[model samples]
Target: MLSAGPTPRVSLDTWEFVIAAENGTEHRWSWQELMALPQETPMVDIHCVTHWSKLGTTWQGVSLDTLLDGVDTGAHFALAHSYGGYTTNLPLDDLRGGRAWVAHTFDGAPLAPEHGGPARLLVPHLYFWKSAKWVRGIRLKTMDEPGFWETAGYHDYGDPWREQRYQGD
Candidate 1:
């Protein structure tokens, strides 16, 4: 059985996509430093490889392009580091595409813990696992790598469009 927790709220700040998250299964970020990731455009649908398609969910966070702005991500790749050491890897090019975002709010409301609020990587193009929950920081690498799901049987490239969900990858 599961229980519901308090609802989350979107911060007025967060335009630059900057956020401060803590170690939590639900969406929980510190108050003093934490702020709802700012508003964004060009939102999209979410397709979970688990056979669930949560559509038209609005989110506000920094776009991959905006986050990587000014910072040199070298030429390797990127890794999303989450609480409890969960991680996911991606090609530098894909991360640079700007489709991905660090979501703090959902559907015009604050993100609930079950929804990966406070800070969750929102990569609508990839499978849900690629969007690591309880996300903390992003480490851009120099190679197309894999993370917890990728190492397990999930696809290395979790492209929802291509239906790439498993390790035959």
Candidate 2:
């Protein structure tokens, strides 16, 4: 396990995982399946919307890059399907550079719910909400669709370093 700093044992705070579809197809993932998916580990930092950055978070999960490797979506956009009907969209190219991952474990252990456990999308370059909690699946789309936060006036592509938090940019 290659890590940059002190790695803490991650934990999911004993809560059930919720997985639902935006198209009304409901499916809840079990703890077993969350643990069974193939894993690609990368040590990263998290930038929360509340204006704090947590560094050196070791995460292990199925990389969207790896999962979508051979599959030909031939589409430009995609939606991150999550629990509670929450979703965020992104361009397919943004998923490159190891920045996008479907993370299950953080710091050598299962991710805690407060930290977006069971499964969450880790788009490290964007705001934390984009790192959604309870991720079920991703819907690859040809047209761009905004998500919960985006509809609430947040930036469509939340680039934190530039303070892209609102819709102006």
Candidate 3:
């Protein structure tokens, strides 16, 4: 299991997932609320920037499309924020159209805290780090903004197949 630092302890009854728009609008969903939405089981291959690849991983959660349904925004990018002060930026296109999910389960079990429990952003098409753990919300932006790792020299847009690991890679 991978974690940013010490695992965060969350209480199911009080935790929530939020989605904020560039227009100053915000939507919040509790764990039960998210579970009530449409859920999908996606089988994906995850490649870590650190050079490890895990194939055929199964995840179940609400699609990002479903989560953003009916929300209006002219943003071209999204910055996913996590509870542990971790963030990752992705093009809005990468997050929509069934490309990503707010995943809560993995391998037929609830996601472990060390692996980002409660809910995490799952963008399978990009390197695993783009899938921010302990995800709490997404902030829409009309302009791209470098996130935590990106500002730390990781590639702003991490496409594993292209091996975009570092800033100049």
CA lDDT of each candidate? 0.64, 0.69, 0.90
| Candidate that would win on lDDT | 3
Q: Of 1 and 3, which scores higher on TM-score? A: 3
The total of clashing pairs for model 3 equals: 0
**lDDT of residue 76 for candidate 2:** 76
Per-residue lDDT tens digits for candidate 2, residues 12-65, read 444234322334433443556555667788887778777789998788887766
Candidate 3 matches the true fold with a TM-score of 0.96
- What's the residue-level lDDT of 81 in candidate 3? 90
TM-score of 1: 0.74
Q: Model 2, poorest ten-residue lDDT window?
A: 1-10
Per-residue lDDT tens digits for candidate 1, residues 91-160, read 6566667778777677777666666656678888777777766567776555566788778777887888
Ranking by lDDT: 3, 2, 1
RMSD of 3: 1.2
Instruction: Give every collision pair in model 3.
Output: none
- Candidate 2 lDDT at 121 equals 84
**Which is superior by TM-score, 1 or 2?**
2
